[model samples]
Target chain A: MSQKTILNDSHRALGAKMVDFGGWDMPLSYGSQIEEHHAVRRDAGMFDVSHMTVVDLAGARTREFLRHLLANNVDKLKAPGKALYSCMLDETGGVIDDLIVYFLEEAFFRVVVNAATRDKDLAWIRSQAAAFDVAVTERPELAMIAVQGPNARARVATLLSPEVAAKALKIGKFVAFEGDGLFIARTGYTGEDGFEIIVPEGEAVALWQRLVDAGVAPAGLGARDTLRLEAGMNLYGQDMDESVTPWEAALAWTVSLDEGRAFIGREALEQQRAAGVPREMIGLVMDEKGVLRHGQKVLTEAGDGEILSGTFSPTLGKAIAFARVPAGAGSSLRVDIRGREVPVRIARIPFVRDGKPFDAA
Target chain B: MSEIPGDLKFMKSHEWARVEDNGTVTVGISEHAQGLLGDLVYVELPNVGDTAQAGQAAAVVESVKAASDVYSPVSGEIVAVNEALADKPETINEDAYGDGWIFVVKLTNREELEELLDPDAYAEAIENEED
Candidate 1:
């Protein structure tokens, strides 16, 4: 049997089409997936992301522990409630999971990880925490709802007290503010401006209802996937796994190889960088009217590669994808979708930003 | 609640077939099938005059998640296809039994229609699969 979120029954009440994602029965869509996708791009949409695992790390040396555990440097988060996106890598430089860590204090940092990687992530996290004398506590009593879009923050703001809403809306990007029994983070997986709010389990359903009444469309995992893809966000399992490195996953920016901090995967990353990484991840855009899907063979100048994550972008009205090809592969490429070698152009990722098509460099 | 038209025949695989008065058969997926596929993004139709072997993939429909093969319900020569679906595939999700019809086939063997399950049988099959 699959696990159910606090909002599972609420989702069904709203006519959600549920699917077993990872081990949780989650909503795949409320109704028209395209409409939900458009909602996030244009106005506002809320997703029941309660299946995501939240872990709180507490100890005197929590910051030092994260410095050694994550590929990204945590020293950059000098201010409280600031979040950082990083990859938890193995000793061999392969990525274990990609996560968001919010530093509330030196002794306390909150981390949110993917639901599918819950077991392994917890195991790895706990094992490492024990050595650092840090307490790793899982907050299963919390539920997360990501209200995302240009108007998402404004819609969500109406739910909070006036002072709290003012502070939350004024919070810097990638920051969090807690008030009114909620942990509201000005962070989102979708490219849109929004909040990923964490609330106690008992209040999740009510909060969801308030957001819906505020005109936030009820979206699902389907819209979330497309939105994140357009934002050039990497999904942990599909985009990279234990056998893939951050460098090969188009996440070299996340790795910080400084002088002192010898992180878990630092040596391996340094070695790979010194020897020159053999594979590279690139973004794909198809102008033709066919949806590009995962596992499609991409034929490039240097060699061949498979698509990592591919989907139809509702905002662009075209197909977009991520493919890991040979390091020296040129922009001229063809993706063998089924049997036909369909032509595709390389695009700078974060295909859409702020509700419009982004020509990122 | 997806509708199962009593006059139409259904395949266990979810394709629906309706016989026209002119001795040709119209093919489309059932409402249940379209509901499962979510919103359609693209549709690949077989060419006119193409041979559609019964139970074989004669057309393709793609959603945001994945692409699905629309199996030919009966063996026939492809007489006409709903070309409008190439531009607006969501029609299937809207009126699957009517404007969403995929192709028109001049049936090569009318006996194949008898092999299809009736509406009641198809509904039962859907229930069984849902379990």
Candidate 2:
């Protein structure tokens, strides 16, 4: 049976095209995927991300448990309500999942992980927490909604309770706060200012309706994929998996190698860091006509690589992709599209940022 | 859903073949097909004068999600191809039954038209699919 989110009925009521995405019945789009993509870029839009799993770790040793479990150090989250992006890894230094952990207090930390990797992630977290005695509780009863764009926060603020709205407005980027029963976070997958609000499942439909009435466009997974891709955000399964490492996936910045912290996969990563990473993730733009797609062969001057995620950037008006190539590959490259070699230009990540395309040289 | 004009015959695979007054059959992907595909990002139409076999892959239609093969409904020689698709593939999504017609072909066997589905039958076929 396909899983249904708390907002499944709300999406259907909005005339969304529902599809089976990673076992969950999620909306692909309300109408036009391209229009939804543009809405998140130019105006405010909302997505029902309740399908993702939210796990709350609560115990006196919560901080200690996380410090040893996550690849990124949780020490940076000294301030309450601060959020940190980190990757959970296996013993071999491969990414299990990338997630956001919000530190509410010394005893409580809330982590949100990908839906498809929920089972494996939960098992890994539980197995690690067994030694630290941290209680890991999966919050499936909470529904998540991400409202994004330049006007996203303001629109969401208007729909939420005054107390919650006030606190959310003041929350810094990558921070989260709890007001009443709501967990409002100033974080999002789209490269836009927004809030990822987690509320009781029973209250989600009403909240979603309120946001829609507040002029937040109802976007779907289709737009979410395009927006995140253009933003240079990595999709867990596509960009990195058990066989791929954070260092090779252009996410080395997230990993902490502080001398004292002995986190899972730290040893392998340290060895790799000393030896040098064999592959590096790079952003590519198809200079010629043709949509760069995932699994398409990317032929670089140094060696060949495969596109991890590629799409026609509605904002850029052309095709762009994230490719895993040999380290030290130059700016110029080519990709095989339907047997034709299409010229590509290696550019800085985030083809678009802050509602505009990055200046290309 | 727009009415499939009676003058035009359709293939079960969701392609329409219009027999023009000059005895040529102009073929295009149906509106239903385009609606199902969502959006058309790229189209590869066969070259003019290329011989197309019935039920063969005559063209390629790609959307953001996946690529699909456009099959020939009738064996014919391509008389003309729609060059407009090269620059604006979205035209197929905008006007699948009219301006978005793929190619014009000179039919090899006019009797092959009998094998195609009528508008009502085609509609029924699609409805059955949803069930």
The TM-score of candidate 2 is: 0.96
DockQ of each: 0.87, 0.52
Model 1 pairs whose backbones collide: none
Across B76-98, the per-residue lDDT of candidate 1 in tens digits comes to: 89999999998899898899999
Tell me the spans in candidate 2 whose CA falls farther than 4 Å from its real position: A328-332, A359-361
| Chain B structural similarity as TM-score, candidate 2 | 0.96
Residue A323 lDDT (model 2)? 97
Worst 10 residues of 2 chain B by lDDT: B60-69
Q: Model-by-model lDDT, in order?
A: 0.93, 0.89
lDDT of 2 by residue, A1-361 (tens): 8999989888898889899988999999888888888899998999999999999999999999999999999999999999999999999999999999999999999999999999999999999998998999999999999999999999988876888788879878999888868888999999999999999999999999989889999998888998998898999999999998899999999999887999999998989888999999989887666678899998877899999999878888788899999887776788998788888988888888997888432
The C-alpha TM-scores of every prediction are 0.98, 0.96
lDDT of 2 at A228: 95
